[model samples]
Target: MTNPYKSYLSIGEKLDKSKFILATFHLQSENQPPARNASASDAGGFDQTAGGVAAESSVGTWTDVSLQEKILWENLRGRVVELDEKASIIRIAYPLELFEPGNIPQFLSSIAGNVFGLSEVSALRLMDIELPEVYVRSFPGPFLGIDGIRKITGISDRPFLGSIIKPKLGLSAQEHIAASMEVYDSGIDLVKDDENLTSQTFNNFYTRVDEGTKRMKEAGYLKEGRQKIYAYNITASYEEMLKRAEYVVDRGGNCLMMDVLTAGFASVCGIRNRNFGKIIHAHRAMHAAFTRSKQYGISMLVIAKLARLAGVDSLHTGLLPAVFTRDTCLTW
Candidate 1:
């Protein structure tokens, strides 16, 4: 038999002491097949498939269990420990009630037999049920979330209006900042540097931030506290980004923005974990490579969860009721 998550069980009980371990699960089994002659050095190796060791076998299948909501079985840290057992191939236990109720079934179906336990059909009919962390774990959402954003900007009811300073390919720093000013003064809620505006020879980031943020601030005062602007600090490196962020704050900029996709996951996570005193606006630029294919690409829902975990205060989720239309606003 296989122990997919034994060590995680002991770690789970002591997770409070170390935030590093997201979640853990304990799998018990009975009348299980004996462990094959696998080498200890091959514990985490990937070549086990070519070593001729037989994989997990299933006994039964799922039938017709149905549920209204989707189910999710998350492994917060994405690691599992194992435990020895006695008839069942393996019995897994996880935290109950923390999932979104939208991805559970698919998850159960995936781990069936050969890996964790349940058989194929049995996995399919698992129904929508919440599991305990002993089985899985989810990460922390934005330190300052959507509600925090509204509070920070002092806006409520409708969505926070936003736009990007564009023509990123051709605009000079002055032109870009000037365009930003137009959006700021128009009483729009937010303005951002399109992802491409990062320290291009045509537009130095320092010069643009100095000019754009200054104008936006003036416009904010004239709006009688109605609208606000956020300048993106998508500079070259982490330190540079942080430096630009500080500069923006020093100039009294209210919010900050970034193209999370362009910067990479760790960058987003680092920015989110900081105490920047501003709403972290995340742009999903370059997301198509991972989300364009329905079957092959990752689900937007999953990306959203990871973004939240990485600390994005707000994100650009295509326009409301305008995803597949012709007009810009009609099909964003």
Candidate 2:
């Protein structure tokens, strides 16, 4: 019996890595039809699914298309170069011409998009993307990198010390300010709003910026050489966000926090594009809904990379493990 999709598979072939964008996926495929030998390892089923993924993600469909009648597959298509059925992993490479330059959404759409919804594969996870240097250099990098942040915050001796304000929400504008002062006294250098916090009636954005900035300014001499930094949450409609960011900058606020996952990558790049001069703090709220599953959805490393390209000064990865404490020694 001939496998109709066998032409799509290129396992163990030597090729140029630079000509294509490579991605690795964890795959589980459904075994279909007469090839079902329960005692045999389902190698045939997995191979078909791999070809389907490469084709669906690049330039093929359920059946052959007329486009192939006139166009050459060499110029555009995804090639499956490696597979490990035991590990449930397969690597696919899409020609660079298949993706748009300087467009992250388009890149993701082609690679991490429709292939997930395919019935041929029961489980699939995008593990990572290896992009070319030209593609990587297309987008703007960090606005305020580590050295820039150190220059602004005057904390070059060690990493900044900060804490997430307890009681994630429900704090009045006054209460938020009071909490900020309390943390400052304990030698905390940075304080940020909760991810869900926004312009609630009780804690309006204008009121918080007006009052909080004054309090932050008064506490400027928290130490002999360092000043306090409050990362006010500006996660909202993109229009409203710009206005709020402008207000923060107008009132001399030194930092702005945004929920990168919910607000989208455009907002991150938008903030940096405006060059508002405030530190961009990125929060990954609602990430576990997708990233927590190893057999589904996007990778956190990819998210971090996009945020870096979009210009985030700081990002909350996760809480420290219980192993470390105040008494812990350091060697940095």
Candidate with top lDDT is 2
Candidate 1: which stretches are off by over 4 Å? 1-140, 222-227, 320-332
Q: Please write out the lDDT profile of model 2 over residues 1-332, one tens digit for every residue.
A: 34435567899878777777889899998565423232344336788888888988888776656658535775686888999989999999888888877676777789888999987878998877787787777767677787777877788989788887768778889898888889988988888888998899878888988888888778673233366788899999999999999999898888899999899887778878898866899888876665767778777776777777777888877654463331121101
Candidate 1, run of 10 with poorest lDDT: 50-59
Give the distance in Å from residue 192's predicted Cα in candidate 2 to where it truly belongs. Answer: 0.9
TM-score of candidate 1 relative to the true fold: 0.57
Per-residue CA lDDT of model 1 for 201-233, tens digit only, reads 888877877776667656554243453756565
lDDT at residue 256 of model 2 (Cα atoms): 90
Tell me how many residue pairs clash in candidate 1.
34
